[model samples]
Target chain A: MRFTRYLAFLNKPYLLLLGYIFLSVVLMNFSDTASLQGVRWALLQVLNVVDSFKTEFTYRKNLEAENERLKKENFYLHITNQRMREMVLENARLRELLNLKTEHSYDFIAARVIAESSEKGINSRVLNVGEQGGVRENMAVVNAEGLVGKIIGVSAHQSIVQVLTDLNCRVGARLEKSREKGIVGWGGDPWLDLEYIPKNIRVEPGELVITSGLSEIYPEGLKIGVVTDFSETDYDMFMSVRVKPAVNFNALEEVFVIKTEIPENIARE
Target chain B: MNKSHLRYLLVFLAALLVQSTIVKYMEIVHWRPDLLLIILVMYAVQYGRKLGSTAGFLVGVSSDLISGGLLGLGALSKTITGFIAGGVSRLFQERSQFIFTLFLGGLIHDLIYFYINTLGKEVAWRVIWFVHIIPNLFYTAIVGMVIYYFAGRWLKADD
Candidate 1:
């Protein structure tokens, strides 16, 4: 009788909340359960349907203006493509003469952005492509402007991309002018920080930064960002350089996944 | 179940839908408002601490599951926020002060969530507070005002 009275006195809502918390903690510890992933995939599919309807309504209203813009973009791209083809042939001949291997060829798979991280500090996005579309984990994603992110998680019809601005994201980068290699990472700000370059090397503002091909994920010579600021601390041997990313992350609508098979040797690296 | 309970359920579902679809597109300076947090706070203020905390935990869990994030972190942070918001509600009586309550609630929620999420990480507290917490607080508060206005009318009609 005393135990029953004590139970009644305690707030039921609080008890229920505690129970929920306990359950969540247990589920989180075993988060890799296939059932959990299936539920997430199902929810994403339903949400995607709603997202598509909304996008269609908005696109229909701007169809005429978008068509004109696309036409202009297509004309410019055609000219650029011809020049790129010529350069590729010349580069291939040069590589053969140097006895260098041409192993960096990649096919592109286009995907649409479905949803982005809802939390304020987290930087991630969901794409409408998945294993079915040839998107796999660790595949680098890019847009017309530049690199966007890499695939972190994938289901049957959707995948998650850890955008460049995310805290965990890091890329091997090089200064376009000086060719000094460094590790670039998000500094919990809009700008990226380039680290590990010796202070002796002169890095100036407005210098272009690009992928150094050191990272197996990103291709060499892809534009990363432009140097916006540079400084050095007396205690540290490395100069602190800030880079403003080439891609406008806030307005990302579509991206292409680079589908390249990692050779055994490169994969080991 | 009671009619009020059913009403809260609908509000929760609607908030979740809006958050995933519309709110995802409404980013400002890489920060977005927390719509579900606003709903949790409003319900907490209208009802009491116990119910508010319970709602918060549920909302956070649902969000974590849907977004594919670390699960317990959201539940832990939001549960605390709900309890605090319920206590804070006692100090205010004016309908106009609802926005202020929501803002305070949002601020508290973000701070707790940020702390919980970045515990082991080497992120500077100043950056997390300024760059993320502050913007989210103000945006959530603004959105909360709009939601409270419509919610108030809905509640009046139900009565």
Candidate 2:
């Protein structure tokens, strides 16, 4: 009677709950069973629809993270690519300079343009190599293109170069075709003025001008420029010649300093 | 089954669907309220301990199976939570203050679930409490109050 009363109070549903819990415990122990796994797999397939929807909503945050990562990667790649291109161009320029040195039998010291004067009227540059690297006053600096400048001042590890465009610069130049010689100097303009050529000399446009080797500063046959314009005044005994320099001074980066010891015969001549 | 039993089943299914689909958007600081836990708490509080424990076991089993979590883990934790909530029901009248019961029940459920989940893991107690358990408790309580208010009305109307 007591058991029946207790059953009635607990209810039929509660009794079934006890039975279900027992079965669930048994199923839990056999969770790795094929049948249970199959059931779990079936339920998972149904639940995956809801999971996919959740993933779709949450994908924006993930995509943003991935975008930031890619942007950083692209920035690094851009810097590296720029550096690689610069290195390739430098390699080619250095190779050309090496060939020029070998062909001319030049005793040369390579130097990089470290700093340039900011003054507008001044055409001067600072090289990384100085007196410590065998650079001296008035040493000729040239590149594969042509004559650049001369070293005017030297420190232990740095030197100052006065470029050909400077008003103070004067080089002994000779016309390639006629062998006519003149003094090349800047006349407050972009072109160099080749002065002291006799009026009778036949100087023409596009004629090659080179170092005459008479000044003891630059070697013979080193290019100065090509004669661009020439005119003779009736009152003057010399022709006025304008020459465009072979080297682009504005874009100068690397250069070679000639360290040849002058021969007694050539120096005396 | 009976009308009440059918009602509970429908509510459970609806809660599960919302938890899976929409509740993620309600997260604050990467924490979301447990809608299914709220529903389970409400059912356990309305009915007796035996019925409450039974509902918890079934729901926990279903959750584990669907989520591919460890077998019997959720069932064991939820069952204990249901039993505790059922025992605590006697201290307060079920109709006058059912929301309190729901909050307490949800808290207990979360505490038990977190404890079981963190076992054997190297997670600190403070991290588990602050990062996971505390935020979830408050969120579940607030959301559960709203659900209970509407569900209570529906239950009364059905009666």
Among the numbered candidates, top lDDT falls to 1
Candidate 1, residues A75-157, lDDT tens digits: the string is: 99999999999999999999999999986667999998888766655678889999999887788899989889888778888
Clash pairs of candidate 2? none
| TM-scores for all predictions | 0.89, 0.45
Under CAPRI classification, how is model 2 graded? incorrect
- For model 1, the superposed segments whose C-alpha errors exceed 4 Å read A1-21, A262-269, B155-158
Q: Per-residue alpha-carbon lDDT of model 2 for A24-119, expressed as tens digits?
A: 567558766667656654554444455556556757658989799999999999999999999978877998988743234668999976544322
Q: What digit string (tens of lDDT, one per residue) describes model 1 on residues B20-44?
A: 7688577777767888888788778
Q: Residue by residue across B1-159, what tens digits does model 2's lDDT show?
A: 667778889888776656544554575654567776777777777676787788888777776554434456567656656655766777887564556666677667666665654556433466556655677678788887787777755743444
Inter-residue clash pairs, candidate 1: none
RMSD value for candidate 2:
33.9
